[model samples]
Target: MPRFGEDYHHFHSQPEPSAAYSTSLSSWAPSEQQRSLPPPRWSSSASWFVPPTRLLALLLLLTVALQPALARALDEEGEGSGDGGKGGDFSVDMYHIPKPFQFVETPRDMQVIEERAASFFCHTSDAAEVSVQWRKNGQAILPSSTTASAEDVPGGSVLTILPKMKDNNATFECVAENALGDTISAQASLTVYEDNANAIPEGFPQFRLAEMEEEEPDKFPVFWPLAIEVEPDVLEVNCEATGDPEPKIKWFKSMRPLELKNPRYSVLAPGRLQIKISREEDDGTLYSCMAVNEKGVVFSGVFGLYHLE
Candidate 1:
């Protein structure tokens, strides 16, 4: 029924035979023990086969003419079928699908899944509306063959490929969304070959933007363009740095770590291992940042305190 649909519900439109049709015929069919006997008139014993053969043909003809009655009897017995078969509407589906509806920790960012092992699937129940977002770690992927249809309503959005190579462990994710709230998906990972491979590998897990952090309103650092803009009785300046996985900022003054101190200034963000300095004589000095991560430390743009000019 490929021309129609592969579903079990799709029975041909013609009427189906009754269940009782097979069973009831057994009762009406001829019995072998009572089969008609051979004629006594000088006949070979082999001729005993002729009468039973003729009786069989007669019974078959009778059953053919009476098929309608047999079918009707089945209907009375609740075993008859209708066009497309009434039983086809059982409407019970028990397809086995993965459940528990949770995900493992997302793979590390910037990692690629190896070829062959690099395979993934995307899913969405709202194909007519919002779609499944493919995130490596937490980034979206665009495909040239992206497709959807209500006819295939809630269609499965899948991506499967045997990557030719791999370099790092990779995590793949598919997120399904609709007018309802979005559902973040569980993560799947892949293993890849060493970096020496000619190809970087396929099916890299998606990259993720650093998680955004919250800041305390009063403690948030502010940059002033003018010294007079702040209190004339300024005793010290405190800075607070906030970032994901923490950002370490080294305060610099005059292109170097400020060398003077009055013990009045203090760093608000302890994670930066911040140091502060203050001096009445150096009130107008310039200060900036030397921030660092796994890569290395770097300075921020210079900011001036009290302007001399």
Candidate 2:
């Protein structure tokens, strides 16, 4: 028997391979010749088809590259063209954006006869997302059988309260709230008047100003100016009167009969004219209210309304 090294040399030296066998072996080996040949049809088609993992990686790169361009397009569409520009077709729902509440009109100072119903209104710029509540003397007012009742109205809220002598000089305010923050309105006061026990027998209408407590029950009319000058928002000009038959009230502006159509100018109640002042045209305008019954017609003293600078 041969040694291990001797046996390996013996196997290698056995015989020279045939020409056909040598050719076949060289063709099967990895060499330049194998590489030079055209690939099989199946292999060429499979090379063009990408693998799942590599395809996903390419998609991620494309998305990242396009992100900045998409953002710029959206911003350009929303930008305003000028002061009066109405932006693109895609309108942002203003309701989604949080905005602080603002007041267009606040409650006005009121004077009402004892046992009569008094209405105080609060108007807001945008009411879709705003909530309103009425307060009395810095405390929240809730609805009850004998207490003030608050109700939601178009663009704002209304508070109705039946007053007694105890309610005189009570301060009232309205608070509005929205997603961003809340706003508190300027305070207004309520003045309650009691019936006089020593009343003269009422025959004809006699006019009395809100500042005055009483008037002589006469058939003739008298007038007085407003107690103080006030700025815009809401103003209640009241003309109190007494008569055997209740008097019908009418309001005038600049010495002419006021045509009350819009909510800006309306009578909140008899003898009480409520005006929502907004335009420059309303400045320095004289306002007066009249009380009329079958006996006679009485006009209150004229007062001018001006918008503060």
Candidate 3:
């Protein structure tokens, strides 16, 4: 045998391969093989091969194309539904009938000295729209009268009288009227007394101090000048006084006048003061009582309160 190198060279130097063999070899190459293979078989329709971006674009176009048709259909349906339809032309009327004339405030019974002028007020709920009139003893009171006169007020009318002994035991009423209806208030009476010197002497009022009892053992008296520690308890202070003329008693806290009408405080008589202790704020509160008359005035010593811990 010849040498191996000499034999390989002699075999490669043979004639070119056949056309069919060359074609098969070319198909075996990576690029050519991929191109020659058959396409893959899908389980479903060709739509599965569509890209997600293209599918999203197609959906958006469909929605935009259908919007105007959907709107037109809704409008036609609304028109057929009559007044109850959405976006349909309609109106609603709301009204309230006028309320009948009613009294808001009425005059109270009054007592006055002889030859003194007194005024009675009559108020109504709708005074600006309603007409107000005053009547005395079932007879209409004239606006131009020497002894009595009726005058228009902001919310009602006023009946003023220059009282005499003959005007005693008289009845007065307020009448309110409007287009809707009319109403009359309860009758108010006037009492007149003769002015006598012996009944009340002309002099200044006098005041006297008194102690109040404690409700609890730890509680302090209301009239103590020094601060006293006390538990939560109701407290009371009373000032007794006598004068030539009767005096009115008023209570004060920290120099401010106390409202006697408050439910927390009570003025049993002119001089007595009662307080209910409900909170810690009542501690260290300065309290004073005063008596007033036509002639003069008197005040009690200031007292302080504190809460007991």
Model 2: which ten-residue window has the lowest total lDDT?
Answer: 38-47
Worst 10 residues of 1 by lDDT: 204-213
Instruction: Return the TM-score for each candidate structure.
Output: 0.22, 0.37, 0.36
Tell me the tens digit of each residue's lDDT in model 2 across 153-262. Answer: 65577676778789989999988875556655667888765633232234545566434334644212246646232453776677767776888776766545466886
lDDT of 3 by residue, 3-68 (tens): 444444555554555443446655644444334544434432343467779999999999999978
Query: Which is better, 1 or 3, measured by TM-score?
Result: 3
Which runs in model 3 stand beyond 4 Å of their true positions?
1-93, 97-100, 199-309
What do the candidate models score in CA lDDT, each in turn?
0.41, 0.64, 0.62
Model 1 lDDT tens row, 145-230: 23211111132343433333432354566675555555656566655443232333322211121122235332212232222223
Query: Which candidate achieves the best lDDT against the true structure?
Result: 2
Candidate 2, residue 194: the lDDT equals 60
Supply the global lDDT for candidate 1: 0.41
Which residue runs of candidate 1 sit more than 4 Å off their true CA positions? Answer: 1-118, 122-130, 144-155, 162-167, 194-309
